[model samples]
Target: MIDLHVHTAISDSSLSISEVVRLAKDKGISHLAITDHDTTKGLQEAIKVGYEIGINIVPGIEISAYDYQRDKRAHILGLYIEPGHPSLNMLCAPLVQRRKQASYEMFRKIKAAGYDISWVDVQKYEGGTGVYKQHIMHALLDKGYCGSIYDDLYKRLFQRGNTPKTQGIAYIQLEYIDARAAILAVREAGGIAILAHPGQLNNYDAIDEWVELGLGGIEVFHPSHQEDDRQKSMLYAQKHKLVITGGSDFHGFYGDKPIELGCHELGEECIDELLQRIKR
Candidate 1:
């Protein structure tokens, strides 16, 4: 299988480059892409390991963007990007900063709510890389302030906690570029942009609108997507002439799921079509 969308430690993923590559090889993945969120830092080591293990590692990144006009959020996955592209790097910088600021604010809120958590404690969970909400959640759990390592972040940290008077707050506002802007940026940088995990978005109407925005592909295969959702995504892709992609979204040993690289299958035809589209 050619799994085009996986995460390494660069994102909220727990898997390191070596472990991801090792798992991919074991899973018989002929082609793999480590599309970590907002950063290409893991691409070098992942590429090196892919060379040693005979897997084709496509350089990719998952960028978060929002359509304020339509009041929607979208994730654009750029595949086969030029790693040294200055424009692409410039585009991702603000996103990283926004995420960091939001994380720190969230941490302060938790601490103010009488939780034995601090910004330093949350930073410690970063593993020197992707500083996402998952890291903050894990940090709180580690400090015995929360119940489990895989706590419901949206509920506990974002909403269900105490009021802002007793807690610091950080709401995820629309950041950087919108979906259309991200797609255009990737196109300018000589890369194909795909909608990553549309099922998770839970807004097919919005996706249909996105397909009209020059989105290059759709991620039809993802662990979180049910069979019915997968089928729906495939139909959408076929109807829109969008390239189809898939991945395990592996975050290493994050709970019960193993970091089985190509655990989610993508058809050979899907890979072929994607390549053809990129060539054009």
Candidate 2:
């Protein structure tokens, strides 16, 4: 099976790249993409490990972008990308720094709220590029504030609201790269740019606009996508001649919910379409 979407500890995933790759190999996944969020810090190591273990590792990334006009999140996934390409680093490096800053601010709020968490506590759990909200939650979970990462407490503390006072106390708005720039950067980095999980973020309305910006594919299968969503994405792909792909979006224990590796299948035809477009 091929899992076109995945994350490792290089981002928010709880498992390291080697562990993720080994697990996928055990589950019979032949092709696995390490599309960690905004960073390609360990793709070369993962590629090396996957090569030795007989799994094809696709160097990829998921950019946290936004549709400014529609005012919604529109993440872009670059498949078969050249890890550390200048375009990607230029577009995403600031995003990583911004997120790290926001997370520290959130940590401050959480600590002020009487949570017994500390920076060292959070850092020890963080396996890669900067501190994620999940890292903070890991600390809180240990302090008995929450049972799981995405539980009610997580929503109450982190979910976005209309205004500052109304928003989650720990929530801070992040500056995301424009969706157009995200697609263009991915293309400049020599990969096919795919609109990721449009259903989850209601980004359907922006697909036509993004396709014009060189959005080359759509994620028809994702943990967040329902049957109707799958059909809609497939229809969109047909209408636009976009490559169709899917994956587990696995983040190990840091996932929003439980899911398995290689649970979603991307047929060879669809996989071949992406492979043919890959310039890296």
Candidate 3:
């Protein structure tokens, strides 16, 4: 089985590249993609580890993008990316800075809220690619400021809506490139751009628009997707003659539930089709 979406410590995940490879091997995942958010920095290390561990590691990335026409944000997954693609690097450069700036602001807000935390505390969890909200939350949890990662404490502080006590501590939103640009960057990098987890986006209405913008496929199966969502995505893919892919979206110990490396996966047939698309 193949999982096309995954994140490592280079992004918001708790697991390192080597650790993720080991867990994927243990879970019997034959093929995997280290689709870290906004960066491909981990792919080289993951590819090296996968070679030693007998698993196929596909270089990939997940770009956070916005659709200005629809006023919505979505994640675009680039599978089988060229690690040193100039276009990918160009697109990610600004994002890296943007993420760091946002993280700095978030840390300041949290510190001002009287939490015994600092930017240095949050930076300790980052793997040098960028700082994520998860890293900040993890730091807060580690310092006993929050009981659970996704509990009320998290919502109160980071989520948009909160009680008066936590209202001023809300998360700062980061700027993102348009989804069209993300899809184009993937194409420029010689990778297939797949819409990631439409169910989570709740933006199926914009699928046709995305296709027009050069989206090559859809994430038909995901940890966050239900059976009905998978069926809907399958039908959509069939209708559009698009490749279908799935993955665990693994981010060890970072999510609400226990997300195993290969808990969700693409069958051999789906993998074959996706591979064919990449080869084309």
Candidate 4:
């Protein structure tokens, strides 16, 4: 099986790159992608471990982009990316800084709310990408402030719409690039831009709009997608002639659901089709 979407410590995930590669091998994942949020820093390490463990690691990244019309954000996954792509680096640099600032602000808010946490605590969980909200939550969990990650306790405190003021905790909104710009950046980096989990977007009507912007694929199989959602996505992909992909979206026990590596698989045909679209 091939997983086109996966995260490691470089993002908000608990697993390290080596650990993720090991788990993917154990799960019989012949091909995998380290599409960490906003950064490709883990791809090099993941690719090295994949070589040692006989798994093919595709260099990838998950970029956050906003839809101004709908006023919602979407994640765009770039698969088979060139690790040294200058365009990708230029695109992610500002985002990295933004994430760091946002995390620091959130930490300050938590401290002001009498949580007894500090930037040092959150920094301990960061895996070089930046301090993500998950790292903050991990610090909170470690400090016994939250019972579990993504639970009601977490949502009440950190979830959007339940701001720091609402939950009496600290929160800061991260910035995102325009969705069209994100897709163009992926293409500029010579990567195939795939819409990550259309069902999660809940904006199926906008598929054509993204396709027009050079979206090369769609995630038809995802842990959060229901059977009906998958079918609808498949139909949409066929209608728009888009490549199909899938993944566990694994975060190593950090998510609400217990998602195991290889739990969701992208078909070999789909993988081949997507690879054909890659510039290299």
Candidate 5:
């Protein structure tokens, strides 16, 4: 099996690089991609460990991006990326720092709202890059405030809303990079830039615009995509001659949904197609 979207503790995931890699390998994943959010800090280590254990590790990053015209989030996945490329490093470092700061501000807001959670409590769930809302939610879950990460408590605190009345109490908007820049950076970093789960974000309208800006592929099979979404994405991919890819998008316990690693059972040929585009 080939799972092209996985995360490790370098970002918001609960498992570290080695742990996730081992888990994927055990799950019959011959080809695995570590598309951690934003940062590529541990790609080399992940690749090294994968090689040592006889699994192919595709160095990748899921860029947190935005479509300014539609005001929707657009995440770009850079597959087979040159992890140490100056373009990617320069682009991601600032994002990691800013997101960490944003998490701190969220912690403050949650604390002020009379949540019995501390920064230290949340810190227990953090990985290398910084704390994410999932970490905070995990903290809340630990305190018995909520049943799971996606429960009502999480929605009340992190869901995006317009006015104070509807807005998530601890939510703060982080300025993501423009979709165009994200694709360009992925290309410049020697990777194929694929749209990551447009169905989940309701970001279909921006695909044509992004494709024109060097977007190379689309994620067709994901935990977030339904059968209708899969068909829609297949049509889009075929029309644009974009590569078809998929994965479990695993983050361990930090996952937005409870999903297993390599759950999609995608074929290994998808990686070949992605490489063909990179070669072009």
Candidate 6:
């Protein structure tokens, strides 16, 4: 079986690359991808371990990009891309800066609200060079400001546009590539362009619009995707000639949810077809 999407310590994920690779080998997965959010630093270690354990590891990155055509947020999963692609670096540089700045501001806000936290403390919680809100949430949990380490972030904090205070704490906005540009970037990077998880996005019409905007595939097997939702993506793939992909989206110990590695297995034929599509 093959699982196409995963995260490691490189991007707010608790599991280190080694741990995730070991888990994949243990789960009998033949192929896996370490598609960490906007970072490929973990791929080198994970790829080494995958070779040692006989699991085919595809280098991937989950890039956060805006969809100007749809006027919403979207992500593109770039598989088998060259690590130093000029466009990829250009796309990720601003995102990292935005996340870092946003984290600094959020840390100050949380401290002002009497959370006993500081930007330095928050930086220590960061899994990578970039500090996302997930790291801040983890810092809050570690400091005992929040009840549980597994509390809902959307309900408590980092709900995108939600207010933690009466006026709300100002957050940072990462500049991202639009749908057309993102698709072009993935293609230029020698990777397959697939929509990450449409389940989180409630807009089916927007998804269809993305498919039209050169989205080569859709994630049919995601952690939060129900059978019905899976079927919806499957139908979309069939209708749009999109390759269907699946994964656990594992975030590690920081997450309250339980998503076993290689939990959702893509059929061998599907994997073969996906490879074939990429070769073209």
The candidate that wins on TM-score is: 2
Q: Which segments of model 3 are wrong by more than 4 Å?
A: 161-168, 263-265
Q: Which residue segments of model 1 deviate by more than 4 Å?
A: 127-130, 152-154, 160-176, 206-213, 255-259
Residue-wise lDDT of candidate 2 within 216-271, one digit each (tens)? Answer: 99999999999999999999999999999898999999998889998445756666
Is candidate 2 or 3 superior in lDDT? 2
Residue-level lDDT for 265 in candidate 5: 46
lDDT of 1 by residue, 18-57 (tens): 8888888887888888888777776888889999989888
Clashes of each: 1, 0, 0, 0, 0, 0
Instruction: Using TM-score as the measure, name the better of candidate 2 and candidate 4.
Output: 2
1-280 per-residue lDDT for model 4 (tens digits): 8788888888888888998899899888888889988777867778888998899988999998888778887889998888858888888889889988887887787777778877888898888888887888888899887778776657655667644456425556778877888899899888889888878887577788989988988888898799988999999899988888888888896766788887345557766787777734
Per-residue accuracy of model 6 over 157-234 as CA lDDT, tens digit each:
454553435334535455776656777777788888888887776435666666665678888888878888888888
Clashing pairs in 4: none
Residue pairs that clash (backbone atoms under 3 angstroms), model 3: none
Question: Could you tell me how far off, in angstroms, the CA of residue 149 lies in candidate 1 after the best superposition?
Answer: 2.9
What ranges in model 5 sit over 4 Å off?
A: 263-265
Model 2: worst 10 consecutive residues (lDDT sum): 263-272
Best candidate according to lDDT: 2
Using Cα atoms with residue i matched to residue i, what is each candidate's TM-score against the true structure?
0.86, 0.97, 0.94, 0.94, 0.96, 0.90
lDDT of 3 by residue, 1-280 (tens): 6788899998888888999999889888888989998888868889999999899998999998887778778999999888868998898789889888887887788787788977888888988686888888888898987777787877766775335554536577678878888999998888899999999887688888879878899998888899999899988899899998888898888877788777344666766776898777
TM-score for predicted model 5 compared with the true structure: 0.96
Evaluated at residue 277, the lDDT of candidate 2 is: 72
Which is the winner by TM-score between candidate 2 and candidate 3?
Answer: 2
For model 2, the superposed segments whose C-alpha errors exceed 4 Å read none
